[model samples]
Target: MSVCKHIRNQGYSQREFLVLRRWAIYPHPSVPHYTNKLFTHHELQHSDYLSQLCIGYRHILFWARWVVTVIWRCIFCAYHKLFGRKYTPLPPIEDLALVQSATTLAEWIRRGKRSAESVVRAYIHRIQTVNATLNALVDERFAAALEEAREVDHRLASLTKQEREALADSHPLLGVPFTCKDNIKLTDMNHTGGIVSRRGIKAEQDAVVVARLRMAGAVPLGVSNVPELAMWCETSCTMYGRTNNPYDVTRTPGGSSGGEAALLSSCGTALSIGTDVGGSIRIPSFCCGTFGHKPTSGWVSLEGAGLFPDALNDSFGIQVVGPMCRCARDLTLALQVMAPHAAKDLASKVQHTDLRDLKFWWCEGLDTPLCSPLDPALRHALTAATHYLSTTFEAPLEKLEWPRDMSIATLMWNNKLRDDYRGQPPMTVDMTNRKGRVSLLAEGLRWLCGRGRFTFPLLMMATFQKLLAVNEDPQDSPHYWKPMQEFLMGTLGKTGVLLLPTLPQLAFLHHEFVPNMLDFGHTCIFNTTEMPVTAVPLGLSKDRLPLGLQVVVSPGQDHISLAVAQALEDKFGGWVSPVPVTV
Candidate 1:
């Protein structure tokens, strides 16, 4: 049989077949040029074989690491308990103008209590003061935002209180200034998205969410930075520099949407737009001490956004554009603006539950199979949260088992991507300014020689992850994690929520993500399982870094999760401002 037919019979897609063909014609870093043809033509299945082997070995490593992480966690946590108590105090929030929530600010602007331009200016000043240190605001429209805010104030002047209230319904966020992750388009702004090649590119249009916010009277201040292609967990890229945590300049802000988290926590913007696939929104929010919400899949529009695999067209529902802010209320407001069509229905469905009837399941710092045990501070935060709810609100908090074994969750998420890709044209993975494929091996050599357009993580993903085939995700089904989703929904029903770890530990130091990669997997599970998760901050840890947990609810029951987040915020004081020591 022909090599093409052999690979086809083995169920490789035309895309995969072309990849193998490319290997035969092009030079490989590891394979000799003379032997390339013989290798691809005769042993095409070897690529798939290598992929499966690596994937299996990764799972084996997961369990092996699981054993060591648990034992080490106990000893390390004890050591920290005795000695790790120093904290660098956060500078006081210098401006009272930055303290109000988006909802409060908008109301004040409408009532002529506070000028909208003043609010915009306050935030812009904050951005300017911090961006030098944080590098969070990559693109700016500060002048344009001020003008828009002026227009809003002018329009509101002629309206009565009732009329202003009516206006608030349609333009709920009117007069509030906001920023979005670079992946979300802001018209006439550089959407570099942290990739080197796209340095001077401009967004010709506003992302759907951005437009909705504008329509609602929220002025756009700028776009924030993201990791290249919004792929990796950290936000630094070749184009824009790294974004530092406001809580501690020494630690990272968490990636993909790390800039958004850093900016929000620093009071650069009370609310901002962000996207998440593999815990991008949740992790950064956890790191920078902010509130973030990943809405139920298909709950928000993805039009004009750069989310991979097209969440709008795909059913996997893992990738989503969401809200990252300093307050839980902003999450609901942002979601409403993003999906205005569903606002009424969602509001009606999201009813207040009696504390007694709400089924609250929690995990108090148990170690997951592949992730390190939760840090003592984070574990204590969870215990405090559950204890507060149980005693104060009489919430029925129960200890529950999370994914001690993530082998199934990872496979389910992988299958989800496969199904999403098959539905759409496969996502492009190039880093050059031009819109075309480039040689992975060629890029690697350039990188080694100190001249590469792509980041190291992107290269690694392109090489082995693309070449090495993992086990086939079941092609017959669109709902890859259907059983798991159903089980979770059935368990939570309508009146239940789960408070779980946002990450295993507090934010790590900058460039220290590689070792804790497994812990980030904790966020990915919810994306695949298809639930609404709200990152609720539980004040700062003893180390003065952010401490938080996720409030997850059944599919379509986002209001329940949002409510739980509010309750927790009320008790714990959500998203403490992480000002610099000199602020």
Candidate 2:
């Protein structure tokens, strides 16, 4: 398309105008001397004009990102100046039960060292104490949860030691407490997914994963918050406002599983159930200083929980429900309860692998779409870990390589979701409901005045998704998606693992993701590959917020990633309680 049509199609926003003017006025250093010296009137005729114009456009777009960043940073500063520290500070974890892992908690409850009722009550109190500050626990089932706890205690009291061992094998987490993300239904609890129109809705039944956990004797504490339809990375919506990070309430807790991570980090719950499509589960875990695992594709059921389709695995991957926890071992325990049929086999695979037999590869970000640079703290932490692994384990941490050409990565992803397929979401008309698709133009304009029914991030998502030019020949590009999978699977093989910064940067202030939305490709691309990943909290940054990295392994290797997470926990402390970050 020509520049004129491009501007007309874009509607010439302020940023576009600035970019066009800069492109026309600037003389790129790489341009020949004759162009600047004698071709002022004949520049368009120059051989490099189009290529240089493309370069100049890219240059201006790069600067435009920073300009948007400065603008958002200023808004944050003004907010603090006016609000005078409005968010409440979370009290440090004072109860011993709140600090223990779900795995340990359950063992204690079964062995009679602790009462199941007391453990449930401890989490209930912590959630009550922090929800006012974190806005994470959106709906509670405290009374019901307490009742369930009593039953667990009563049942265990009658069981013989041999029976308890059998119970431990059959129901590993019997008496542990866990929170559920709002999108993952909890019977009689809020199921809004942060959409204002869906405000009064409640779930009639537990999601499949939730049911499994319940059957295993785990008690449900509450439902956590989410972005609209679980689309955005930072958790906030018109219905539930925004969920804040406990370490620094001024920043985000990453979404759409953000609420669960924040609650776990703040000692509100030892474990939680959350769904991931892009990096929903891992991103929040990264920001909150907790552990989260996105299981191998189809390893966990999505029934009654996920809004996205499952066919993405056969075509281009997208959704799965997985466990998020404070400690790494709890991830293994939770997955066993959630997918008991596959537990024994997976346990055997994970136990057989040794770190010495594994190879390591690391990548800063995806080669296709541009990601914001990793924060210095994130970079330093990842580098340090790589160094430790290479020296401590006597393995080389080599740089990862991408396929020769991956420009089609974004198109393939968009086409898969946009194409007609079974189980496909109603993206043809987003913000959909019983009423139907919303008018993007109308809703987007209303949002400008701060009176819209949807959040800006949700609208932004709607706009970008609709803007993808429909692919009339999606069949021709199925081959394009293969290179990434082949490269990842072939290189990693069975026992190999790849390391990546959990995200490009540490968690930013709420809404700051608007300008850098494309960065999610870092996590989304992995989802498309169906690889299993565990987000491990390395430690705190200089600013006291969480710093983390992704430990990705070949498909069907969920346990390998989990095992590595446990090893990391031993080498570097995992899931430290968040302290207030004055900054």
Best-matching candidate per TM-score: 2
Steric clash pairs (candidate 2): none
**TM-score of structure candidate 2:** 0.85
Residue ranges of candidate 2 with Cα displaced over 4 Å:
1-75, 81-85, 307-316, 367-369, 404-412, 419-425, 428-430, 469-471, 477-480, 580-583
Model 1: which residue pairs collide?
51-468, 51-469, 171-216, 174-217, 175-217, 233-255
Q: Write the per-residue lDDT of candidate 2 for residues 1-583, one digit (tens) a residue.
A: 4334533464544444344333432222222221221123244334355545444556565466556656767887677567735877787667788888898898898888999999999889988888998999888989999999999889988999889878877777888999899988889999877887777888888888899998888889889999998988999988888899988888899999999989989988878898887889999999899999998877777787844335334233557788999888888888887877666466666667678778889877654324465567888888888877778888767887553223344554555445435344454254665357788899978988878999888887777777854555544444334445665787788888898887776787777777667767777777766788999999898778888899999888887888788888888898878853232
Highest lDDT scorer: 2
Candidate 1 per-residue lDDT over residues 432-510, each given as its tens digit = 5446767888888999998977778767655644663445554444225555555566667887888888888788666
Candidate 1 TM-score, true structure as reference: 0.81
For model 1, what is the error of residue 111's alpha carbon versus the real structure, in angstroms, after optimal superposition? 1.5
Error of 2 at 94 (Å): 1.3
Candidate 1 ranges beyond 4 A from true positions = 1-92, 307-316, 345-351, 364-369, 402-404, 423-428, 432-434, 467-480, 580-583
